[model samples]
Target: MKIVTGRMASALRLACMASTVVLLAGCTRYGQHGYARYRTNCGICHHGGEGMKGEIPPISGRVDRIAATTEGKQYLMHVLLNGLNGPLDIDGVHYNFSMPPFRTHLSDEEIASILSYLATRGDTQPVPVFSAADVAAERAHPMTTSMVAEERRRLDALHPLP
Candidate 1:
């Protein structure tokens, strides 16, 4: 009876582990979808895969570092909403490429997915899902002074003014 009980316990443990793995897998799938959305929308400038250079920063993994910060996250969202074509210092390298606004091209959910993918792929952090309300808010108000300050400070630190 004891041996049978032990076997049952082991089976239960295995089942629990399997379920947990499945759940984590689902979350990963969601992140991947978000990544795909980002690639479709922002990959032109950000470059999802290797090979491209000089024109824009490789946003796949490097962006997570910037997204980890509060201001960095907001800056990413703002950039998606209101694209910037100024000096960008990514991974200590200066990239002065123009990132045309994708506001009209992608909906807010799409933008959120891209940002979420960037944050997740770049770092171990789990970013909040972008919602329809988030899109509406950004479109209605856009970024304010404080958000801009945070972005500039972080970017300046990465790539000082020449």
Candidate 2:
């Protein structure tokens, strides 16, 4: 997906940020803080975490399972910071592509917001809430894509993802 940046991007989310009061009062706090950003930034490729054609790795209903464990949660954070390249076998589908890193462009809170939005998408299941502090802690030490892939391997050995 082509990630847009600069003045144009800000204009898109300006409306959402401005309406935070209305959203928070009527809906979940998670959606208001992260909705617009997720739509423009993440929704482009992940499509509200539903993914596409098995190549994007849906986060909608499955991310809660991955974020349940501490290690799994870290893996998710690192994937955002370090990005993920190569192939992943999810269920019966083969997902192979490069998930670009947002470490530089996206802030700690932004990453947390998006991840938190994803984590809470599941209905009736309790999910870990990603905070800015959590993202900051993980950001202290960064990893490479290969390292992240290895972490995924380790996490997957214990918990298989969707």
Candidate 3:
């Protein structure tokens, strides 16, 4: 067997260190923007994305799947802008509550960042990124919370959960 020289060993160690740094950075790519926003605005209701079981539907595991579809993406945008009311079922659990509107408190960019953070953080599958432009476009239409709830029903009919 060939033995590595001191120079070669040093180079290998440096390479390993560099690789580790890159891997760590990659793990933290979804930094504070979205998480901070979620904590401040959404965590009150969502409880850090874990929700309150039957009372509040957990968004962490569900959002990525909802964000996968065009209508579902729009639904998320509308829900953020307009809020949501009435009964909703997620993964066989029911949540009937009023989600207050954030349009007055958050900017389009902030909302998009929050959505992006939810979509990416701790998720293994690929999910579509929400841009500021998407939020702005939804903002232009200005649907009421009731309208948003109705749209959610329509979307559920169109794409029933399996």
Candidate 4:
């Protein structure tokens, strides 16, 4: 007959409890599809939309406003598909970091979901939701990062940022 020891039993119980906690934590953190994708992809630099001061532009409230306009919406799609380079001024703060393109890594659906997720954050009014079709359209006509930047400049001239 095998004897069960108290120390071994306690250690096993602790290990099981630790694993359960970890699994639950993961489920809680990645509860939504968009949130999970955003966490894995955009969270590294944007910090879940909390963005670094004067570095990464915070996409929370600001994105929703930008997305409110037609030109801004197309600009957003181009930026995501082609990435953005050079200096960007958001709400009077300057950010010069190069945003990497995610078109290669993420599907149209995923990009739309991430953009939708961003729209919900820090937004007080209703914002246009990005659809997979929108992303696909942008994907069909690929642009260089510099071109994306130029498009943004044109959009800014037309719509202006708030």
Model 4 agreement with the true structure over 53-138: per-residue lDDT tens digits: 89888886777788887777788888888899988888788989899998799999888877776776645365468889989988
State the local distance difference test value for candidate 1. 0.63
Tens digit of lDDT per residue, candidate 1, span 78-109?
Answer: 77777665555555676666566667788877
Better of 3 and 4 by lDDT: 3
Residue-level lDDT of model 3, residues 1-162, one tens digit each, is: 135587788899999999988755633233457778888999998997888977877888667678888888899999999999888888788889889999989999889888888876445466568889999999999888899989988988988731
* The candidate that achieves the highest lDDT relative to the unseen native structure: 3
Off by over 4 Å in 4: 1-31
lDDT of 3: 0.81
lDDT per prediction?
A: 0.63, 0.79, 0.81, 0.80
What TM-score does prediction 2 earn? Answer: 0.79
All candidates: CA RMSD (Å)? 8.7, 9.9, 6.9, 6.9
Clashing pairs in 4: none
| Candidate 4 local lDDT, residue 42 | 88
- In model 3, what lDDT does residue 41 have? 96
